[model samples]
Target: MMGNTRELPAPQRGDSWNTYECATVLCAVDGCDHGACQSGPFFVVSISLDEDKVATTIMYSSDTGTWSTPASLDLGFIESDISISWMHGVLSGGALHFILMHDDARLGVLKYDLGTSCLSEIEPAFEIQSARFDSHALIAPEDGQLGIARLSGFNLSVYWREVCHDQVATWTKSEVIDLKKHLLASNPMISHTELVGSVERTTIIFATTNIGTYMIDLKSLRSKKLTSELRLFNHPWALFPYFSFYNPDKLRTRSI
Candidate 1:
């Protein structure tokens, strides 16, 4: 039950806190192999969106024990009429990915590049433009590229970003998995399904159905029911994967 007692500094734009979109990530220091350990130097990045479609980012460094100046970028789209969903952001390929949503519809994805300090928009594939925002989940980098998984009815479609030698990038449909064939055999009452979240750098995904929640392995095409009863309070976008690490050698020496 470890926690950070230090509080983050307020955003430079005073009213930015009123927005609902924000993400915090702990990243390993360069050339360090500590793997997210607290003893090693690391960076804590925090980002939030302003009402004017600009994103402000502030970073805290363990080495300096100070927070960096807030960096701002204009998202180049007007969303004053719509609201962004309050959901966890995806970090991949040296950038953070957030969904721009309006009601039940997903307008697009906003990407913030940490190294370059640039903000850009990623359009959804044409085939999935009609799908609701709740049916999609941004996957971590697979084979060095970011991907998105969309659940439409009982079928899940995975798409990957492909870059050509000329530096142009595009999204390509990689594969599709039929959940009906994998899950209906055991839980036949599942009438609706929505993507909840995904594990970083893996094919495992968490999904919710009319019956309950499930942990699915896309690699093996297997589904495991995590809960028997549906949890109505668990909104698809609000759920995130929690990861923890510990040293076994140090743990064994502790007096019980």
Candidate 2:
């Protein structure tokens, strides 16, 4: 078992992204369970138990301070999977979306909706499988819709969800960009690659090839080399700035 870190506070109402501050506290969970993604605004957190059960803590923050409490969530189908990805959940459409891995190696999404206070699983539009343990992510694209990006061989494919008023969302393939041709043009030593981060509301996807970091534009199918001085091929993680969707004037008047 390991010790918990100090409580991570949300940004202050009027504080700048670089200057916001919140309180901190010890966060100890039973039996060293796993925790995933912090949903924005309400700041809900999901923790999975050793026995496939899942629970959540709804966090509250303001200029005054930060606090959390147990929240009632229906963690549907959380136990049906073999394992959950360590990747942080993506927040879109009023829910925190997590990528789930089945025992057979198929991938699906589990959504915890803050507004409805419910948890549900959304299957991919097609069979999205990974021979690797973790190789996919749920992204909120520039269109403000939920989509999944998967890496297969040297190609990256993105699919978006098309919602029907009274029916389940239908997934459609929106883009398929070949990374091998683009990366080979810049570096011939490129071999392995993986999706790292999706930024600009996912209009851009950052990936690490065998030689360096690269970015792909979903709209134009253009690719660019970000850095070639360092070999970050094995580093599967990245840091991305928070996406702010508020007006500056109105944000100044609100409390964190």
Candidate 3:
């Protein structure tokens, strides 16, 4: 499992009005054996937006133990109108994908490539772009490709990014799950549903409803209720799923 020991503080810049956001992604450690703990060589990417709506990016490399020089992010023509979402980013295709919001509405996605240190924009599916922000979530499938899951009323639609022969990327609707028929069968009192979080490299996604929270597997349409007592209310995007594994060998040989 990957391990981190140092606390990475955000780079200081701008005044009190600056909005800062950051995300971390594990890097591939060279020549490392299986079951080894990788503590370094990862990346922490921080993005800051000033009052003028200009965005700047700075990256921290664990190998160098230092932050890179901040560079202005060219958001193209829409730079003045959009802002990056604070929601946890989805790592796919060796890039960190963040949601873009325009005046409280979902615009699309922003892609920050780790290898090239370049930024790009990804247009969301038309159906997804028109839906409410909380109803959809960006996900990374097991194949490490970019994908999205949207919950529209009682149905859940999933889309995967596909590249055509012309090298143009498009979103293909893969499948739809009938949530009302499946979820409402057991609990008929479920009023509203919203997609919250997803497990990276897996088909597992978490959703919240007025009744409870559920963990659903997109492959088999199987679901399990994680909690029923805690209602998320209006904050459907509050849940963030984190996965980690503990090495039993280290635990068994501990000095204490």
Give me the candidate number with maximum lDDT. 3
Q: CA lDDT of each candidate?
A: 0.70, 0.59, 0.73
lDDT of 2 by residue, 131-189 (tens): 45435667886465988888877877888888999886888885567777777877788
Q: TM-score, each model? A: 0.82, 0.67, 0.82
What lDDT score is found at residue 73 in candidate 1? Answer: 67
lDDT-better candidate, 1 vs 2: 1
Where is model 2 more than 4 Å wrong at Cα? 1-46, 55-57, 63-81, 129-134, 228-233, 241-256
RMSD of 3: 4.3
lDDT of 2 at 246: 34
- Note the residue pairs that clash in candidate 2: 7-25, 13-255, 13-256
Model 1, position 130, has a per-residue lDDT of 57
